[model samples]
Target: MSLDTTTLLAIVAMALVTYVTRIAGLFVADRLVLTGRAKAAFDAIPPAVLVAVIAPTALTTGWVEAIAAAITAVAAFRLPLLGTVAVGVISVVLLRNVL
Candidate 1:
């Protein structure tokens, strides 16, 4: 199969843009500081993004997934990121098998 010129150019452009943005973020992040409410809000971003990603899948799937998501949410507050993810995976697998 032959590579199309337009497709090759598009792929190269996308890769360049992605690399540039990531490098820029690293530079900007090093110089940035957060304090007070801003720090709190910044700290909350990860869990909020996690929930945002998980919520739609949980809501759309079924009661089993929704229950598992609830369990995961509880774990998120008490556990580290890896532990919370472990809980989510384990709960979903067990729930799917049992219910």
Candidate 2:
């Protein structure tokens, strides 16, 4: 019911820690390098990581949704990047509304 000093300090400390960690990325970024194969691997990493995380969630939710999502993902992979994203969003929105 009351805001104690310890609780306020803990919240402040947590915020400061989060801010420091995020800003640390910029400090070290200039020292980091992605060359040749490393750059290619880095490019693929995000999509692969995203699919690994999203695929399981979609599967657990529903097979039909997963199939629909797969169709959208394939379109995203083959088409122009912005066009793919637009088609994917429209497909999912339509699927949700109509199906």
Instruction: Choose the strongest candidate by TM-score.
Output: 1
- lDDT string, candidate 1, 1-99, tens digits: 999999999999999999999999899988889899988998999878977997998999999999998999899889998999999999999999999
Residue-level error in angstroms, candidate 2, position 59: 3.0
TM-score of each: 0.76, 0.70
lDDT per residue, candidate 2, 1-99, as tens digits?
Answer: 899999999999999999999899788766879899978987998889988998888778876567677877889768987987787677777787877
Mark the regions of model 1 whose C-alpha exceeds 4 Å error after superposition.
80-86
C-alpha RMSD values across all candidates: 2.3, 2.7
Best by lDDT: 1
Q: Which ten residues in a row have the lowest lDDT in candidate 2?
A: 60-69
